[model samples]
Target chain A: MASFPVILFEGGDVPDSLAYRAGKLGAEAYPNVEFLDVAGPRILMAPISCLGAGFAPDFHGFIEYRATDQGCPLTQVMVDAVAAGGLCLSACTASLLACDPVQVFCATVLRLAPSIDAMMVELALAEAVGNAVIHGNLGLKSDLRHSLAGLVEFNGRIAEQLRDPTLAARRVQMTALPYGDNGVEIQVSDDGDGFDVEHELGKPLEVGAKSGRGLALIRKVSTHIEGGRGGRTLVMRFLPAG
Target chain B: MDIFTDSHSDGTRFTLKGVMSFRDRDAFSVILDAVNQRAGAKVTVDLTALEHVDSFGIGLFLLANEQAVGVGSSLHLLNPQGDVSRIFDLANLDAILSLKQTMPATGATARNSAPPRRIGIDYRHLGKAEDGSPCVGFSGRLVFAEHGHFQEIVENLIANGGPRVVLDLSELEFMDSAGLSMIMIAHEEAEAKQIALVLRNPKGAVAQLLSLSALEFMLEA
Candidate 1:
């Protein structure tokens, strides 16, 4: 692969100029970009997360984070890491919802670049920070019931839809079920000998793990977790983010 | 994809309106970084309009989650429409990333407290399957030559429980070490949890995978 610098951008709609200029000027990847619009807060981390992993970086750094209708806390976390690392960072007034105080934590791997164009594609630079903060507080900060309710509200408003609407809708309908103060029910079913729990849960769901760390994070934070081939179920008690 | 933002005096909120996949990482990265400047503020990611997500899509989210925590803030994903939810579930990301639904046009945002989502097996609590038992019901496909849908299977089991688990190998046509390991992982998980992790009747390709691993005897022996 050609040696290229990691270009992390704030998530939002990238104007044709920056997108075109970046691509034309040798940009390796976009963590989140869509169409001509780079709805971002994405990463072009270290040319590659690992050295010599041989990822088909095909059209990297072009992630399309479609959560504009709401807020995304994850976007802020990713930005803090990328920008905090050694890379170029930029932002846009439009990308920001408002100016609020936010702090993101990540191991220092990439550089942080603060720019105006960055905002156009940035998810948390200005607009997304608050959402991330709220995500941590929604459920856990309140009583158990409120936490669960906050979770449902969280799920209903931000999480799945932004990642993949089709999948999010299907999952919400198939898996999640609410039963009053009891909590929210999440069903996970599959064909294999009931999937692997040791690999996905109780442990970090990062790289090597089949399902990865995100799975572990969601499950851990959730109130309850369950599932099986005969049809499994994940019952989240709906606690606020702790 | 377009970017939408809702601003408040204290902070700002953003909604990304488009398909979330590998194609848009660059754009997404920039936006997420910008959000980090503000510490401990609330931001929301609305997905009532998202369409797809793959490995790259998953990566984008992982990137965002990392950034959210850095500056003392968090990410909030909202209103996943369709296909989007399945992507998360398949990736088992539903556990970490919130997958919200649009309350019926009923306009009743049932702010009620959440209840525990339960899994009551419809099948009887049948004991383990017989040796070389013929596999029966099966759904999903091979993810890897060895493991295939193994990870997904375990994810489901974790969120839900089954009286009897059926690893219908009838439809399965291949296997490998990864595949076998996945099965073992699931088996172990069930045992540890004291749940009945039964490998239903096995045959053909499905049977071959187990036999090759010499797990057949251990499974039913």
Candidate 2:
């Protein structure tokens, strides 16, 4: 089971620049399958045939190749596979503010597990990306939401920060991986200063409490939460009952 | 999010369609401004069509409640269903805002009975304190997302010749680091004007945060 081959499929729309970055990040496992063109049914059938050939036969999951282009259309075969209870994972590297990473991530997760509550997934992803953009990359404090003037100032600062080449160029890399038969792990990392995860986790958050509620909710819903690289990288695991 | 307003003799009613999240801040602000303008009128916000609400949206409701109180008007939340209501219940907003299943019938006698007051934010104009000093009372969560507006209101009160202000946080449920920063900013602003800004009754999370930050001296008896 440990020798199960992890396949990687590259779509036609992926740009050369993004491909280079993905390669440099070691986004995919070595000697895996790669599909460059979606012009034929082979791209969709390849995974099924691989499974039929007893290659990672016990493994029933999909890992999407990460790239910049979001226009990679899903085929009926892929949808059918997910519907048949096969887990699906997708990875994407997005710009700090240019892409709606939450939407894309949540949509993919929902498709993978349609039985899961939509709001729960949406909230979790929103908090993840929001933290990555506002607190991680932009270095905005959570308390800035306390006042209208502060919100205005916060917005202004976000705009100003994004105008800086160093800040704007920072990327947020997100990867969704299957953990077990019933669990999914989402890892989001931002290129910014991380915080004291232990200190934040130590704070006592009462139910109905407003401050730090998002992370608290995320903690409640996720099976396990792990932080690394000074809290710049967060991995959340969710096991929705099928 | 789309917000539609309808005016009636009793008050104005706003209907919110679609998700009411942080993304709808502009639309929420429009509603807040409209409600503030109609102070003294019974303002009702119908969330029956609302699909979802985030923490920031919930914070906006708390702020609107404070604004309503400031203008002598009342704000009522009408018919929040599914996720919208669940988020409200989870946050215990029902303890703070007036939640109604249905709106009052038009042309009916206006109900003069005040709604139950729960643990929420409110501002009181204290003409003078026990020591013959001017003061004000602020109750509820003074955390981020609500801090800037809260600061502005406090600043305006201070600018209006109130040299001394005592913000009452007895009912405050929570205060984040941002809230602490705002308080410090207010304290400094008051100091520059040769005024005293005191925080009264810091309890619960507010007290814990102040103590942890080693700024408990801001609290007064």
Candidate 3:
């Protein structure tokens, strides 16, 4: 299961086998992927590329991946997911972002809003790193993380329901966002901001904790996977329905 | 509107026949006083004929439930509709209270979710985004473009009431971060402002989102 599932299909084609396997996994998966420039950058779309594809009892938590365009958009997927349901996690920053907001579901539904980000970076940077670390040797690891995150969100919802029976009747809004190149940098934010991240590990932890679990996730959702985070950015268009 | 109540030695079942809202909080308060004298019985509420329910209705139900349980009683809801259920759903009471599609024969319920009055609070609008993306207004999904305003919404609410308020989002079909932040900001404002802010009558997609964000408790008064 992927940790932070994408809520929109930036654009790509899902391999037929992966689609079938995802369906068997009790999640709505896709085989055909499409490519588009819905957000910060554009790249090849792959499986689990569309928005509003799979949802859980809580309607929050989604997984997404990207091989290029840095990690700006990737951060956005997590942000949007968190806002919808109060939690989100991502592997590398290079992911999809530029897509229709309505097409994706915000884990939580509310009336108040800030505005939309309109900036976009049209160039591809750090090709070698993205292809190697992210898409190359360990793609499926990240994919599974994204998928699993969705399940976790669902499970959490069920638990919450039991504690407060009244909670089971609330509403959920699911939404996604494409991070601007370099992401707006939400430093000095709240403590929970670094939930997915091990804030205890100081500012930047290299390559993150052990790769065993991550590698396993890569193998599960390998086709739509990529390796490495391009140093420059991690934002790209999401193919939510591939 | 007249509210019908059936109090027994083991349980108290109330059937709301007409409009329920804030205006009846006093009447409810008075009735609960008498009911508590003979507590320990379960409380079951049946809202089969309740025309509408509001945030105040949610408060009534919660108050009644608390009151009943304080006296060794429980609150049970039976056969609630979308409007009423939506309010309960948003409050996350479905899990807290014994909400049933059909009335259970026994329990301690005071039919509090039924609003005490109907002030014609019915005003709905649907809208869409610029990208041909489908969205309804008010209840439609929200999309905030900035983070600063989000901070402001909370600050403002703080100025208005102690972060003690409930946002009724069961009616909304779509929502964005900006919208979510608005609720959060309002909740924060309620906290700083010392107002009670809570989300009531959440259902389906909306409830899932609130719980996942772990904001259910934070938003509740």
Candidate 4:
């Protein structure tokens, strides 16, 4: 029998329906699961003790709540993971305020493998996020980077998209999972129209070619790459030198 | 990215610090504008402090080189280090640009008092071709920084009314995508002028790239 704990806050903004759903999901996933309401004074102490005992919750569900404050236990857990080089999964809304997803993802991975080549990691992340931002969310063509006028137009389009709330509100999520003892699997996905991954992948790199180098460069740096969601999602595996 | 410019009687020196990528497009444009303003004046760009560069940055260098030709001046790159230097090597820019390990001494007094230019390229005119048309010979690497000089030389040859312009690349050791682009542009210009632009003796990686791109038609036996 497996057991899991679920935290429920009384004054938190999480809806009751969401909590019910989380409970149902947990019960269906696990045979023996306990939902712990940490709102009461007595129950709060119990949750704190569980956390002190290194009982990491398998599933943490927060609905319609901001967890930016350090006081949030879940947020603290993520921070600790980043500092101690542990597994962390994060999802963020695609907005200018969220910063570059590539930079954030690379920074986290760098913490795990400090000896890895920084430039290689940077190039891989840049290519991934660039594909997501320009081709995915903004719906810009890669060939636009071929000429000066086209590049200018591309930048202008990106700037315009950034200003539109409807476009900027789309979500881009990145997940860094452990592959092996010293390998990492990075997945980047965006909510946009997928591209022709097969066509892009098949194109050969030629001299004097203006565009179509980003994916090639990414593939060269990563150990393995796979595309999904009609090419809206990119999964790259990198092995850092031990 | 930070661009600092210092102008003297010898030339205008532009020092770039930080990563040169798409994010620095506006800043790079400003540098291009400055290069355009100083037409016919020698321009030197120092990239020792640059940490990284992307494809856009490489394209921008080619664009700036083209602009430098329009103004009748030449541009040179100095002191590329780390990944910045590696990018140039990977792009095989040595054959197309005038890349030097250090700058030339300006004057007797300046040679001792001033700092060496670090890396510089010298442009030499190779006189007329077999048909009495203009022949330009480049001896060093021609990377992004040397595109300006390469363009200026080609434009000057075109202006001389040569039926066929021969570019002697026997001594060139490397040529990157930017260099290839410049050559292609020159070829187009020559075609427009009804003149044949011939690439003479492209060796090593330059030959490989040209052949791979199926641009061997421009090569001369």
Per candidate, chain B TM-score? 0.44, 0.47, 0.45, 0.45
lDDT of 4 by residue, B1-221 (tens): 89998988888888899877656778887668766876577878888677656545765787787788888778788876554554566567766555555743221210111111212123345688777877776554443324325545556657756578788776554454445655666666677889888888887646754664566877886
Error of 1 at B107 (Å): 19
Residue-wise C-alpha lDDT for candidate 2, range B1-221, written one tens digit per residue: 88998989898899998866555767788668866885577889998787666556777899999999898888999987655664576578999999987743221111111111112244555467677666665554453334325555656657745467676666555554545656666666677777888888876556755665556777775
- Please report, in order, the local distance difference test score of every candidate based on alpha carbons: 0.36, 0.56, 0.36, 0.55
- Tens-digit lDDT track for model 3 on B78-174? 8876346544654588766677885532111111122112112221212322333222212433332222223433443344333233345655543
What residue runs in model 4 are displaced by over 4 Å at the alpha carbon?
Answer: A1-98, B1-221
Query: Per-residue lDDT for B206 in model 1?
Result: 50
Q: Candidate 2's residue-wise lDDT over A1-242, tens digit each?
A: 12222223323343444334434432222223343322211212122112211112223333333332343323222333333443332222223243232443454565555556554555556566667767787787756544445556775776677677666555455555555755676666676799776677779864323246546556765778878878997778777765
| Model 1 C-alpha lDDT per residue in residues A5-51, reported as the tens digit of each score | 33433344444444554565444334333333443223432211121
* CAPRI quality of model 1: incorrect
Query: What DockQ results do all the predictions give, each relative to the true complex?
Result: 0.02, 0.02, 0.01, 0.02
Best by lDDT: 2
- Model 4 scores a C-alpha lDDT of 0.55
For each candidate in turn, give its C-alpha RMSD to the true structure in angstroms: 24.4, 14.3, 20.1, 16.7
Off by over 4 Å in 3: A1-242, B7-11, B103-221
The DockQ-based CAPRI class assigned to model 3 is: incorrect
